[model samples]
Target: MAEEEISQISAGEFEAVSQLLSSSESLQLAFIIMILGIIGIVFGYRKFSSWVGSQKFYYKRPHFSRFVRRAVLPFFAIALITAINVHTQTGVLFGEISSIEDETISAHEQFAKILNTFNILVIGYTISHLVPIILTKREKSILEKEDFDAWFELRGFSDDSEDLFHKLYKWVPPNNAPEDIDEKEFQELLNTEKGRQYLEQFRTSKGNPIGGYEKLVDNPFEEWKKSERAKYEKYYQNCITGNNQSGRKLKPGTKPDEIFPIDVWREEKREHGYESLIPSSRPPGYAKKKREGLPKSAKQILPLGIFLATILAVVAWWGVDLIVLATATGGFSIGLGLALQETMQNYFAYIMIRKDKIFVEGDRVQLETGYNGYVHKITPRVTYIRDALNESIAVIPTRQLVNAQIVNYTKENKLVPAVVKVGVSYLNNPRQVASILVKVGKRGMREIVDTRGRHLVKQKRCPYLDKNKPSCGCDKELHVDATQPVVRFNEFNDSSLDFSMWLYVRDYGAQFKTKTDLRMIMYEEFKKYDIRIPWPIRTVYQGDEKKEFEEISELDPDRDKVIDEFGMGDIGRGEGDE
Candidate 1:
């Protein structure tokens, strides 16, 4: 029986070969078509890639063009496979051909299915890459247009969506409705579908859909009350947690029970709320309200979207049951989690740092561990700080930075406070010394501020009168009452009276120069005033000086000669020389 079955299979294979030999012409034509199609696909892909690379949008985003180019090969492969299958099945390419056996047809179908699955994977991957690029481009367009409403809509806010509930059930006047329409006419117009659709685009200040009437459906000022309450809540929480977004802690002796007025909290938040990655060209107090904005949000969401799509595609194409897939996914996830625990922690910390506006690039920060520097760059895992003291880049892990105490000297204002300590003799009057210190501080402040102001005017960046002018009285405009130089009598030391001269410089970088200027000025002023800066003086009493002199004479025979040459005859005497 086995021999008979084998002989039958062999006979079937021989018959299939004979049929192929009978249609050599069709086979050659099919082979020629495939070869030409492949050649055309290759040439077309290169041209398309070049064209895409040349376009302005893709030129700016080379990665997007690369992704597009990578997708071309798989796309052409699918197209070629489809063309071959169609010509084989329909015989339209030749218009006359020998019949293909069921076995051959079945094999082709199986092969096509496998290729199609692979094509789907490639297409899905391409889509994943393109989604972020598209989103980024859209965000850039909206930003360039300065269309905040479109941005809000892209973020899925209700301000851009139609209020279905108000449109159907409520009847109120749209905020933007024609003022000419009377109550009666407006009501009549609302009965029509066109009027309703037209009015649907407008909304009341409270975010309700505007209807036929001119009045709002809800209390117009209720939203303001809710907004104020929310602000107060956040302010209260921030105060309690000491997370003021500036990375500064509350001053010592601050009353925990003291709650600032909502207005004060609102103003504070308004001042410190937004941080720009680069310096803005806008005027001061023009709050940006958004940081990296929609582009960053899209970048964050795209990764997760890609991850979920990949898992779905795997399950769909591989025909794996959900239960087995879930089990394998769980084990894989556990292993990945364990391996990337520290990395994930740092990434999340980086997110927190960015969201909270703790500190940004170019901010001068002093860590509790004595690492003081300007933040050069911030990455997912590490923050690079150019050390101010050593002029070296310090790489700190994001997780460690988030947990460490940081003093952001340039957060609220660029002006940094500098102190110059001076010690004067007790004979000098404290009031006189204080006056001299204040004069020195004021001199230093004027010199530095004038120099900086002149530089700004040269650069046409002075915020005073005419920016283009060489000097527009910027000194008066730049001066702040709070930053005026002051003198503090801090403490009394053994040698002299300690006093600190405090003044503000233009920025953290200017503080060192300002301090040096103050010290030099103070030195000259003290000398002119005859104010003595006393040094520590010690008095020593020697008992039995004659015996001490005898021991010295025994140790060195040339003691008398050295004393005669140096005129030190009084060294063994009781008289003291200081």
Candidate 2:
């Protein structure tokens, strides 16, 4: 397209198209073909597209559809642009009277046309690529064939080559005991309708349906011999024939049991031997039916193709109109202004957060506003998080999440060894108490402790720090400037020495469970040692100390020195009431 545009046609590429046009005599006809070439691009593309739509490529891989959309747009664009380029760059033929310079105008016009064609090709490929995907179809490949195979192997059926009918012998257990079969598995086979349908199709196609001895019997040469003797006769004949080996030449001393008879694998019993090659030959669909497993089908890629085509159509007409309208008049771009405000904010913040890579789903995150929760689902617009209690969920906008201070409990790593604190008697050994608390924490949530994470978590590297060593969850990270409670001795109580000890936690949600375990372990461990938690104490005083009479009480008793305590001061004598 570029070569054709700006009259920048390469000599070889021009010659290739020019040679074909020269063979035709009519210049007018040649010009029309160029027009049709532009038109044929549309037609050929539709034909190619119709062919593409017929194919079922993405039937199984419905999830990975965005890649198809991204690929398809570019392909259509390139094909259209190339066709237009081939048409325009090879200038339409003029009569012999025309000079090369006379043809320059048509060349320039075609060049402009090619340039404009390509410009339309690539308008907004990126926005549609990054947009949230909502495909037309939504079917999961639930009944994968392998799940069925595992289910079937649980049953007595072997692989395809082992049908077992040839070596079939029903075990005539000494007392005719009942056979054991799983009802759940039998029910599952019947329940899987799609699998059953596929199996029926496969069986019909192969002209077999897992036939048993009775189903295959049809009739005997002697239907007249319908007695019990016939049953025993057929059974014994097959059994003894396998053991006898009448066809093979044998040495005189070699007995049937000693000669490794095929009938009885264990030489102790020379009975009818059976091998399992028939079941292995069973069609793959048979196993699937037996196990209630079904083969996966591909997703409909054409729906995505049609959807992208509509997006392109809208983008071309509406997008070009908007741009052209604004460009023609000096109108303000209200849409651009509104779009940029939100888009730019999200774009920059998404970059920063992605670059930082601090938190992920399932982490307990606390906002600066005191909204604390477990990260449930993170969408582009909002993040849904369950509160620390796990009862209520909070929807945090991207703007708030990006602007606010966020802390993750399982940020660095999981298996966060947490501690429990109690204000017990000062006599208690804080070290033993810490040990017991840690033990309780380990045993309490050992089952629920999740270890699935990046390699860094397992390796215990930087960023995924070990909080217990020097860092603790109770305190805000030292690097962060946030309100954190440093150690404080708030009071001195009566029965026990009061102090606050902040401890670590794996997550805030686990706070309740860890607290319970800690209280239990502390109670159990503190019983061995006499550690008591004290309550607040208050003291009582009898007399009012607001006014003092201490100096008058020390004075030697004299009629002149005696003083009153009721309305008393350290004064001499009062004669009048005033």
Q: Pick the TM-score winner.
A: 1
Residues 88-146, candidate 2: write the lDDT tens digits: 45553332213223353353343434345444444334333433233322211222233
RMSD, model 2, all Cα superposed?
Answer: 28.8
Tens digit of lDDT per residue, candidate 1, span 308-411? 78757655544445554455466567889999999999989989989999999889999887888898878787888888875698888889988898999888
The candidate 1 region of ten consecutive residues with least summed lDDT is 456-465
* Pairs in steric clash, model 1: 172-211, 173-213
Whole-model lDDT per candidate? 0.55, 0.39
TM-score of 1: 0.46
Q: TM-score each candidate.
A: 0.46, 0.35
